[model samples]
Target: MTPRSRPTAGGSTALPGTDFGHLTESTRPLVELDDAARIRSIRSERWIGYPQARSVLGHLETLLSWPDRQRMPNLLLLGSTNNGKSMIIEKFRRTHPPTSLSDREQIPVLCVQMPPEPSPSRFYLAVLAALGTPIRPHSRVPDLERQALMLLRATKVRMLIVDELHNVLAGRDNARREFLNMLRFLGNDLRIPLVGVGTRDAYLAIRTDPQLENRFAPMTLPTWTNTPQARSLMASFAASYPLRQPSHLASPEMTDYLLTRCEGTIGELSTLLTSAAVLAVDTGAEAITPGVLERTEYLGPTERRRQFERHLP
Candidate 1:
């Protein structure tokens, strides 16, 4: 067969290419799958792109089009733990997957997790690895930095996303200052937007340096509440659960239980629904109800954090 006419792998399209157009604009992809495929889809990790997530994506898209950068604008996306910050950024990244250029990939958006402790060398290492260009195994800091910056340019990276930026705060004061300075230099050097994503502590970190603080416009994903938007988001999520019966998650009783159990965070809410959906499938119930949720063993973020804190000292 001609290369252009290569057959799809074993014709096994259990997922993808389904008529998911009926789903809400954000979740329409889920509508394409049959029940079994939908159940499998729910089990895997995915991005929901809720309202807050969409807003962040819009901000990043705007930044991508900014002209030659002097005083380039940056973004700081901060929110509570499990409030969907990473998901938002990841969704944006997926929407712009890498493209093949002349014998190399032109990664428009390069994202890396901030090291648990801040160090310029470690930051460079993360970026280099993400770009598939590892520095020498035992290279010095300056060498790693040089290679990373060069590759970031060569690959035409339009945006640099450092998730878990708050981790810098765990390092010493001087280290934090150095990391922030490195970020400033990187932004100025690359002339691309630098997006920082983490909990509220990330805002505190960025605020330490007046220059850095001034550059990043802040966007926060506040905890969800019992509002129409929140209910709509929940409903959108439940619609993808693959259950035969509607979960009616937006009903006041169900919504309150879900919010209370999920601690009003999108990540937790998603996990809870996914877990309940999987269990429903296993039990042959084919639907999520208050009884199913009650039987699920998932714990809310607050309770889980409390449990960990109690064991300390």
Candidate 2:
């Protein structure tokens, strides 16, 4: 009697006629999750249809379209979370490529996400890294800052998008002073538009640095208020994902439930919806249902409690 090879749980044996490599690849996990961070995209299609989102994009476009003779004004994007702030910046870059014709006129959008804890040295290094510069292992704060500015000048970048400006506070009093000096130096000395983006705290951060604050005019991105605009945003979300289709989520009740749960934050909304879609795909459901949404464990304890309380009698 010939011994039989054992088949894997999915039924096909690896040592036999089946192409195991192809089978394993086909059966690979659907939604890729890493260290509690959901890797969802923030693009127009994913953005809940908010007119303000479009407005923000238009504002950035105007900033980028400054004529040859003038200096681009510094812009401050101040808003609470999920107000489509980052989306606007990204969309602007996509719709309008930042490149100048001549070397002196060359334009580049340098986006740097500020760290939770920031110092002068850290800030300089972070900015340089964001600009794709090679950071020397033993470089000092001043060295990095000098190199960053030199590269910025050499590249002639028109706009510097500093996301999470609140991180400058991660330093000591002296560090903060030095960091603000860098901003002042960049604004007055370099003649490039420096756009700062962060939560409401970002506004306060800029306000503290009088020189930096004076250089930037603040623009606020408003959160959805459950008004007609909210409905329009929901409609936009529907259009983007097309819940009615078999290959996606389709529960109207779940959609309303999501809005209630997320409180109309674009980032939270996108995150929740994307998660639900992924859950549906995982469970072999062609359309998302209330049951699937209920089964999700991604919502934080506080958020879930709020959601539960709101729905309760």
Candidate 3:
């Protein structure tokens, strides 16, 4: 056969019928899958689809409505790492926008994640920054507190949701005491309910401050353990991913596999399911399958597992 003539440097060799409009969808990077939209999916049943989620939301609503209840109960949410604490708060924020709450009420739920072993001054600065208050990078602790209080007053934040409350106890005794005192003031002085969320250690930290303990209503939300609710949650999770494995949809075997892999934590399960979906999409599969999930190893090594275990049930 005669060789096809090669186009010169500037000449076009493109196919005559090529249409740029029909470009195939590119594969989305797995890392990019952790964006706010996908991870904060409230529609996913397998993860946030648990019965306890409603209970938590209801408790939050109660606090919002009865902010004046002299008791001013603080909520203590304890669970294992990867236990859906963050997701629950994210979903709550999505469904009940903070802007709406701030307009109608003072001390609306202000969700904040505490830094690991942060100082009282650092904590105050973080709160101020989170509330969008002006703060000098080198400003003094007292200045930050003044600004924070002003922002709180301006925003009308009724309740504060402090995630990873265990951080308060990570500091020195003086630091810990100061943090606790700040919490006391945020609750008693401002009369705003402080909802602290963390792993099991959060419970232990509260014990250090009896006053905080007195004001707090400890609510433990553990990972599912061989229950009907767990299966139902899995079904919901499967529904959220349009490309979820066909075998996993409401299947007992898939539920068991998910439970075993994620160790009953809806958060971990969601992460795994998302990974599996991305993998399926990359491999040109229309749906996720048991094989695809098994092929995608999302969990970490033994050392990482130990780190996660420290925050477990």
What is the RMSD of candidate 3?
9.4
- Candidate 2: C-alpha RMSD to true structure equals 9.9
Ordering by lDDT: 1, 3, 2
Q: Give the per-residue Cα lDDT of candidate 1 at 115.
A: 94
The candidate 1 region of ten consecutive residues with least summed lDDT is 1-10
- Per-prediction TM-score, please? 0.86, 0.70, 0.76
The residue-by-residue lDDT of candidate 3 on 162-278, one tens digit each, is 999887778888878878888887787677778899988888878888888888898878877667787777666555553312325456677777777777776777777777766
Question: What lDDT does model 2 reach?
Answer: 0.63
Model 2 compared with the native: what TM-score? 0.70
Best by TM-score: 1
**Candidate achieving higher TM-score, 2 or 3:** 3
The Cα RMSD of model 1 versus the native structure comes to 7.1
> Candidate 1 residues 220-287, lDDT tens each?
99998888888888778777665544667887767888888888888888899999988876776656
